[model samples]
Target: MTAPESGDVWSFDYLWRWQHERGETEGRKPRPTALVACVKGANGRTNLFILPITKTRPSDDRLAVEIPQIERVRAGLAADLRLWVMIDEYNHDFLETSFYLDPKGRIGRFSSAFHKAVLAAFVQAGREKRLRKVPRYD
Candidate 1:
């Protein structure tokens, strides 16, 4: 729990941008989230960025990557359940001190190759300047 690696998947309260825009401070429930990055800010606190995974198929307007069947198993999710990781947006939280992230909530991890693919797509999303970020901490 001290150091969050990029491929790690965990049950997290991932707040969406729309929810925050509506003045919602916390996520509705803890769901599977993909750890994208962990950065140390100037103040020395580690910032955790994550993408939410959902079973609902993304709309045409949204950008998402489907979790491969093998990778799904690697992540400890139901092998038969179709899931996608939304790359167009991400949830930001404090890794050093967070009320939403619990150590016991950790699931399995995606393979390095899969994580790399997701990261690549995420970086592409960033380049497009359409990535919506929802900051969970004040």
Candidate 2:
């Protein structure tokens, strides 16, 4: 499988496992996520850093960036879909596992401007101490 490039949107099976009010539970949820970075490891596997993309608008604009409806449509999403890139919801996975990049699930790449905005949001999150540090990909 090819490593997904930065700005490329792909469907991810995000495993949500956490200790809730009752006890620990897990769910495999499928969603579209933007590949923000792909770092090749020494073992020849690539580690993918990604941010979740949602169809719902974010309550905090400072933590998200809106992807224009037109751009979303061009990326193979619904024409009327309201998409937002959630910067705070960053996650990582190895290319050999966890991530799925089927052609049918790809939503295409975002514009350079949008990619920059996503990076800026990461910087903001770091400055606010919400994010420890931004991951570097070679």
Candidate 3:
């Protein structure tokens, strides 16, 4: 499979670490994530900025913007799926690191207008202090 570019949605084997009653445990969770940006590091490896795509609506609508069903379908998502771009939920990973990009998980690239809106939301989130981590693409 080729490297994912910005606006492309792919399936990822995400290591979800959470606190358990006994201790911390990790689970391999399959999730659809969007490649927000790709940056070349000093070491020459690409660093990927990614955000999770979800069917669940965020309590704060400002944190997430809904993708129209038709657009979502065009992006290779299920036609009946109600998807939202979770701008506030994002993380960075090196292209050669622990992140696993599943070939079968490739959805499709979002529209240019949607990409622009997502970038705008990121900026708004930063200004509103709603984002836990500010995207480095700025």
Candidate 4:
């Protein structure tokens, strides 16, 4: 997919499955799977996807399995060890507050913040020679 714009539509399931399989192989923990339904704007970028909350042992039951996934995503994109902690904090906040956001602004502010956070993480990771940002299509 050409870089998503504001209005470009993408699938949630595709990104979710991609993250899940990638997490299993390259990650140290299990992460939640995602599925894309549709886009709400014209920017053609990453957007919200469903993450059904599930309670599991040794993990917070409120956030479901998303914490691991968010952390993995952060770590996968982290260039330096410093980002690990920062990303972890951001991940925690995202999972915790996502439910309280006004549905109307989620696509714009909250979703954009999530995407920006990940992008920053990846850029840092790439700059530190941790990984390369490969173009992917969903």
Query: Which candidate leads in TM-score?
Result: 1
Tell me the TM-score of each prediction against the true structure. 0.95, 0.72, 0.77, 0.25
Compose the digit string of candidate 3's lDDT tens values, residues 82-137. 88877765656677653355556777988877877887887687788776542222
Q: Write the per-residue lDDT of candidate 4 for residues 1-138, one digit (tens) a residue.
A: 133232111222122234444752222233222221224536544343332212233233111222334443442422222221111111111222233222322221114445444445534544666442212222
Best by lDDT: 1
Question: All candidates' lDDT scores?
Answer: 0.90, 0.64, 0.68, 0.29
Across 55-133, the per-residue lDDT of candidate 2 in tens digits comes to 7777753377788886686556666778887776566666665524454666677777777778788767867877422
TM-score of 2: 0.72
Q: Identify the runs in model 2 with alpha carbons over 4 angstroms from their true place.
A: 16-27, 41-44, 99-104, 132-138
Model 1 spans with C-alpha error above 4 angstroms: none
The TM-score between candidate 1 and the true structure equals 0.95
Model 3, residue 84: what's the lDDT?
82
> Which digits, one per residue and each the tens of the lDDT, describe model 1 over residues 55-121?
9999999999999999999999989999999999999888877888987878989998999999999
